[model samples]
Target: MTSTTTTPGGPALELDDIQAGALMPRPNPYAGAFWGLRIDDRHAGRELLRRLIPLLKPASSFDPERPVSLGLSLTFTGLRALGVPQESLATFPAEFQQGMAARAAELGDAGENAPEHWDKPLGSADLHVVVAVLARDTVLMESLITLAGDALRDIPGVVPVWYLDVHVPADGREQFGFKDSISEPAIEGTGILGSNPHEASLKAGEFILGYEDETGAVAPLPQPDVLGRNGTYVAFRKLHQRVAAFRQYLQQSAADRAEQEWLAAKMVGRWPSGAPLAVAPDKDDPELATDPTRNNAFLYGDDPQGLKCPLGSHARRMNARDSRINGDVRLHRMIRRGTNYGPSLPSGVTEDDGADRGLMFAFVGAHLGRQFEFVQREWVNDGSFIGTDEKDPLVGANEEGRFTIPNRPIRRRLKALPSFVVNRGGEYCFAPGLQALRWLAELDT
Candidate 1:
């Protein structure tokens, strides 16, 4: 049904495009345009989406306060019919090259023997599952997962249940009021780069911060470690929204609108301007959002105890820009991308003044322990990073397990902290290759 083959002296494979017969030379602007289908056949899953996408109409520009189409996500899982060859284990990069080549040739985006391996991350996926998400909200998605997962498991390669679900939404408010989704990064490539180069380089195993395994450091000879030469591990977390509760808390407390804004700023660790207290230290840089060079440039120059940025401020705690060297930033880095989904606050709420919504945090990198967890636990939760009594003023983990925003905007305080972040749902996954998919296809036959 698809055109694919090896040619004499061709280039390596292209792994960016997930749709069959479509190897995008770059990341698609529409990663937001995806769905899930765990079916009786592997090729069937790929073919179905490939055909369906083209037929579907383009998404319309979003309105600030309304629901758009509900979203669904897919990640691969399980192994029944597929059988990978022994040689593939020994020569994965080469095999990965082969598969990318075949898929690219099939796409006609590249000619036969184009000689290109996926510039994006590839080589681990073999299953697909979906998470249905609501526009302007995060609640329904988790509920849907809890609802639909049972039905989906009946499909093939469904064991351990699901692989990756759909992706996390972009951070930002639909109406653009508070600095929405301030922590989200604009992801580049097929996402295989694993968030950022600093942490991604350590994917094969443990590195600088820790090394529990042998292949922890990058190999001099060019080979992968135990996880599979081309494998990548993905962890996803989805939290819920409690607009009414948040509004009630924000309204009843705080002084005036400016004070409310200050409270909001303190909780998030930044003014809506994206300016870090570490540099601006005192004011909001509203213009930074427009200026690329200025927006994300603040660093914790000499302020160890958050003399500039508050120690527990979201920015300082997450990156520990507050932590330092002869003035060098920590080698550990994570490319974080997140989105806010929920109904906007009712303007007329006299009891609760602000809007009702919450955030979705997503990070991609090699070692989860060093990067994501590090930012969350050490800086955000532990008082040591900032030398303050406050934990991550906003995102500290709650007992229920979700990392939802706190009921009130956290302010500087001398007392013990109340956990703000709460967990709703999450899973870890691997984004694999088309060869893996075909290996999957062959099994179905």
Candidate 2:
């Protein structure tokens, strides 16, 4: 598709106009809520957007000054239900229309997390829109949801079909005891220090529309340019972690306390403290993990042979750093922000609690097919790039899977690892810019 730079000489990101959740996540949100909306009436949905637009928080508005934030995104069905023209809708990425499950094989979601097992609200016929609310604590977040729900109650067409609450422990670990959301791609325009210093910054258009991307060319946009410019797509997923199973595997695979810790780090490519194996291969470095400036400074170029950090590791597979040979890694970058849900299983407990707990995964990008889906299919679920057929050790479908750890005497392979993470539900939506939202609200339809 032919394209032209929309922002041109202007700044790539107008932080004040973009949704807060699209750029950065609220630090330590005590409680978060996601609302799955289905538009039953067209005009009423637009009316709701008209009123809700005033309450949406912009990315620049996030700071110590304001502790609560709310974000809104709409799916292809949501847009169409609100009376968006067919010609205009045709401009969206093709994969977004097919939905995430259409490419299940590439994504390796065919097992437990397959679409058939997904929550009814996610990727369902009724799922049309999504609203994400963030707050400093559970009480405040609930209050906001109540107020928003009350306001929407009068709007006959739009109603919530599903909801979820998300949180992270004060220690910031996911259910599996890893420091989550630690590695992200730095968008050149935002200056967010997304990846480590060794990694180069990605073009802003890779994550946000209207700007030049890695190809030095602008990405294509929908018609009535005002409605499409500055908007980006989001992939939201509810991942359930099998905490009891993961702990049991670690116990049976390792010989001692130290070996158990080392084995876990090898599976994740980072110590539980968040220190990368490439930086602290032999031991955990709590100090380095906590250091904001140095934690992400190391690279994989020196360890090309996967001697320090295994090529098939979770982190290494997700971000190949200097190891990628076939394509420009910058083009495939995404802005990831997520929150953990469910209480941490008591330490040393290896039995199932059966409580629904896992990660609420959110990926923001301009190209859903190339950026988000490509990573899920190629990097996270397969190992051809790293010269092995192994999948991501921590989240991959572990059907007789084997994890290879390069060692001094000989490489150790952990076998028969079970799938530790399962997909509960998810959706693909469009996070529109302030102007696009205004356009939607004012549309004559």
Candidate 3:
């Protein structure tokens, strides 16, 4: 294998060796499935990768006509199961080695969101390989699923542990009725542009290993060049959204339907149509929401007071975007992609329906600690940066929480905000480069 090196002008990324799902955004109106597998035998696990190589698509070969795609990632335990040398294993980052469950408390996954309460095989070491299949519709999605199933059928020691189907609703709104997947950061060599024009392209190393990052430093690769060069860390989370509870909170806090919508937008920093409150603060502009050029093109410099978009809103806290925060916003940026699972709660309903519905969130980047975990801890679960003790209004663990909306006469504050999103379970895995997959398949040990 050839070693990846940087030049005076930044190295051109090995897109052919990079997984498509790790960089490109999913197609809208997409249907997908997530599968967790346990590697009981090292030989079988290696064989699994051999059969999966042709099915996986590279970042540079995306075709609109062939919309189906597949991605593969392995947990730390999975690498060990495949007989990875102890020396190579020690080179991975601490967060990736410890896994998500071990860092629960630091990530605000306490109370009902603890790891012990997580779904089976999710927080456990039994989970080794993660397979994600996605396509434009169910017909295409099922075709790939069948192909993936065939690869695992005759393998003796590769057992299917868990599975979840995901899709975008007809209205393109998440369970809480908000347009999701609206924002993403641009990478220097990928050619994919950022949603916000005001934002500059981040260095490739920020998201891919073996390249220079925002701080002008290349992140430490896992080991032996070939296995870790084009690889990236992925944080997979299953967040259960309490739609009834979310709706009830807005209904009780507001005076009318219009007021309810306004209050919801304040909490989210965007109208239901995917329009940012920074651009359309007074009302929900459907046209602006649909316009790709202007929907996510605003900044927080003018609204430092949080009048248009609350400083603590989910969107602002996640991105910050020129906001006077304690750190560089670009350094903490990562590619976030999500798909809705389970049925949506019917409109005008404010009662618990006992259906498990939420988002299967995936965070992709090279620096997992600084990019993903930092945002979850400081921005989502804590508010000290914005001079408050409140968590994110929509997704944080908000037991008896309060959100303040800055105004001229007096800031109207909403009290007793409940935790609408619960941490069902999650994992820390490494999506190796295409060459690394072949290396693992031919491992002698």
Tell me how far candidate 3 lies from the true structure as C-alpha RMSD in angstroms: 1.6
Which candidate number would show the highest lDDT if scored against the true structure? 3
Q: How would you encode candidate 1's per-residue C-alpha lDDT over 296-390 as one tens digit per residue?
A: 55555576544445555565556654355222234345555454444555643544244334444444444444555555555555555334434
* Cand. 2 TM to true fold: 0.94
In the range 145-229, model 2's lDDT, one tens digit per residue, is 9877876977877887988878866777888888877776766656465657777767778877877788887788877888887
lDDT score of residue 370 within candidate 3 = 94
Q: In model 1, which runs have C-alpha deviations exceeding 4 angstroms?
A: 1-171, 174-177, 180-216, 219-227, 250-253, 325-331, 347-357, 385-390, 398-411, 414-421, 443-445
Question: By descending TM-score, how would the candidates be arranged?
Answer: 3, 2, 1
RMSD of 1: 13.7
Give the best candidate by TM-score: 3
**Could you tell me every candidate's TM-score relative to the true structure?**
0.55, 0.94, 0.98
Worst 10 residues of 1 by lDDT: 21-30
Task: List clashing residue pairs in candidate 3.
Answer: none
**Model 3 Cα lDDT, one tens digit per residue, 1-445:** 4333233358878888988878887788899999999999999999999999999988788776666799999999999999899999999999999999998977999999999999989979999999999999999999999999999988999999999999987667899999988897878877777888999888999998988899998999999899999899999999999999998989898899999999999999999999999999999999999999999998999999999999999999999999998888999998998899999889999999999999999999999899999999999999998888889999998899999999889998999999999999999999999999999999999
